[model samples]
Target: MRNYFIDLLTKEAESNNKIMLMVGDLGFSVVENFKEKYPKQFINAGVAEQNMTGMAAGLASEKFHVFTYSIANFNTFRCSEQIRNDIDYHNYNVTVVSVGGGLSYGALGYSHHAIQDYALMRSFPNMTIYAPGTRSEITNCMKQIFKSKSPAYLRLGKTLPKNFKKLYKPNHCAPGKWTKILECKNPDSRKCILTTGAVIDDAVQMQKKEEFSNYHIYSLPIWGMQYKTLQAKQINKWDEIVTLEDHLEDGGFGSYILECNSNIKTAGETKIKLKSLNKNVCNTVGDQDNLKEHFKFAH
Candidate 1:
């Protein structure tokens, strides 16, 4: 996913001189091609994430679409104040690019875990969350981000999921709009698993199980606080909806869906189920797969 982001950004930068990438002393091997080709468009902000965000905001003020890149938490939680005050508050054209979303960096311990990122990012009214579950989704997400010209967050995973298939033509992503992946064989089936971010692979695997064999698979890669009305309308279409995410229940994708339907009168009939990582996973750390197995996607 990181490779796709850099490659897409590189291609976009060829003609768009206003597009810039700033790193917090990270992305050494992954970002070299962009830096080597467009030296003026890249900035190494050292270890200071706050300064990096502020500088990116300043650049955006001058009509540049700046992307601040770093590991999940460092580019987010560590400098959240700056993100809120400098970029989000002002609606700057700065996209906070975070790699290793969810537990991709579980081996490094809790400090690197990005389980609560959605919680923090969604709190900002102007922020749009872009979490691509597959490589193809990344391209469409970049297109929307460039068009938005406002505060955005690009959450990426360290690697692709096993047995992942590429899409020939991905549709443009929009907040609260779902992109269908696998259709259920049963024509009568109205149940589906909706997911965001890297946990999408888990949703696909879950659908194959006998208990959920008739469920369709869909992903909402772009969403934010402003799309509640749109989400509520979509939720009412299905009889049963299962939301999956690697983050904890509170302030995560599932919680966001529930919040969207809470005030809707017609959405009460739809059953909303949540499958998210157990808080217990925060206590144990080995690697990404091991931690996922320990939690077993707590219901």
Candidate 2:
């Protein structure tokens, strides 16, 4: 996901001089290509995440589309004040790029865990959340963020499959719209699993199981506060919707989905089930797969 982001950003920067990238003293091997190609547009902001975020906001104020890149926690939690006051508050065109979303960096311990990132980013009024589930989705997400002029969050995993089959056409995605990935055999089956990030793989695997064979699968790569109305229109199409996410249940994708329906009088009939990582793995230190097992998210 990181590689794809840099490749796309580098290509976009060639045509659009306003695209700038700032990092918090990280992304060594992965970011050098962009730095070498567009030296003037790239900045290594040392270890000060707060300053980097502020700089991104400052640059965006000058009509530059700035992207602040770092590990999930450092980019979001460590510099949250700057993100809120300088970026989202002003509706700057700054994309907070967070690699290693969810438990992707679990081996590094709790400090690197991004389980609560959605809860934090979603609270900001002008923030747009881009949680892509596959390489195709990542490509679409990058294109959307590049074109969007608002403050956005791009959540990515540390590693991803390169040759996996694409679930949805990348160009068909739009903010708050759900893309149907796997259709159930019976057209009458209205139960589906809706996922927003790397958890889409788990939902696909679950659908292949005999017990869940009748369930469909969908991925929502883009969503946020302003897009709640779009979700309300889609919720009535499904009788039972299972929302899956790597983050904790509280304030995660499922919570957002429920919030979208809370104000609609007719939405109470839909059964929404949230399947998220259990808090038991909050303190565990292991690889991504190991931590997922501890949280009962393993396939």
Candidate 3:
């Protein structure tokens, strides 16, 4: 996912001179391509995440589309104030790029876990949450991010499978929209699995079980506070909606979805289920797969 981000940014920077990238003294081997290609547009902030975020905001104020990159926790929790005041508050065109989201850096311990990142970022009124579930979603999300001049949080895993089943029918994505991955043939089928970020893989695997054959699968790669109003209409169409995410249950994708439909009368009767990582996983130390097993999210 990090490689895809850099490659896409490098390509986009060729024509978009406003595109600038800053790092918190990380992304050594992976970011070199962009650094070498566009030296003037790249900067190493030397471990100062707060300052890096502020710098990105300053650059955005100057009409540059800046991207601040670092490990998930460093780029978010460590510099949240700057992100809120400097970038999100002012509606700057700065994308906070967080690599190793969720427990991707589990081997490094709880300090690096990004399980609560969505809880933090979504609170910002102007922030767009881009949690791509597939390689194609990553590409589509980046394209949309570049085209819009708004504050965004791009959460990425440390590594991703080289190939997977293509979920999006047209292989494209849009903000506040859910792409149909697998469609149910039964017209009466109303239960479906909706996911954001890499958990889409788990949802896909779950759909193959005999008990879940009637369930369809969908992935929502981009969404946030501004897009909440769009949810009620979609939710109205389903009798049962199961949301999955790598983050904790509280304030995660499922919570956000429920919040969106909280006021609707029919929402009371709709079966809304949430499948997220157990908070207990926070104390464990292992790779992503190991952590998933600990949380019982692995299939």
Q: Can you write out model 3's per-residue Cα lDDT over 1-299, one digit (the tens) per residue?
A: 89988999999999988899999999978999899999999999999998999989889999999999999699999999999999998999999999998888889999988899999999999999999877888999998998899999999987664336554544578899988776765757998889888776677677777766788888888999999988888888888888888899898999998998796777676788898899988878999888887678724
lDDT against the true structure, per candidate, is 0.88, 0.88, 0.87
Worst 10 residues of 3 by lDDT: 161-170
Q: CA lDDT of 230 in candidate 1?
A: 86
lDDT of 1 by residue, 2-45 (tens): 98899999999999999999999999789999999999999999
Choose 1 or 3, whichever is better by lDDT: 1
How far residue 13's Cα lies from its native spot in candidate 1, in Å, is: 0.6
Residue-by-residue lDDT tens digits, candidate 2, 1-299: 89888999999999999999999999978999999999999999999998999999999999999999999699999999999999999999999999999999999998988999999999999999999888878888888998899999999987664435756555668999998777877768989889898776678777888867888988898999988889977988888888889899899999999998887789788999898988977878999887887666824
Give the TM-score of each candidate: 0.96, 0.96, 0.95
Error of 1 at 8 (Å): 0.3
Count backbone overlaps in model 2. 0
lDDT score for candidate 2 against the true structure: 0.88
State model 3's lDDT. 0.87
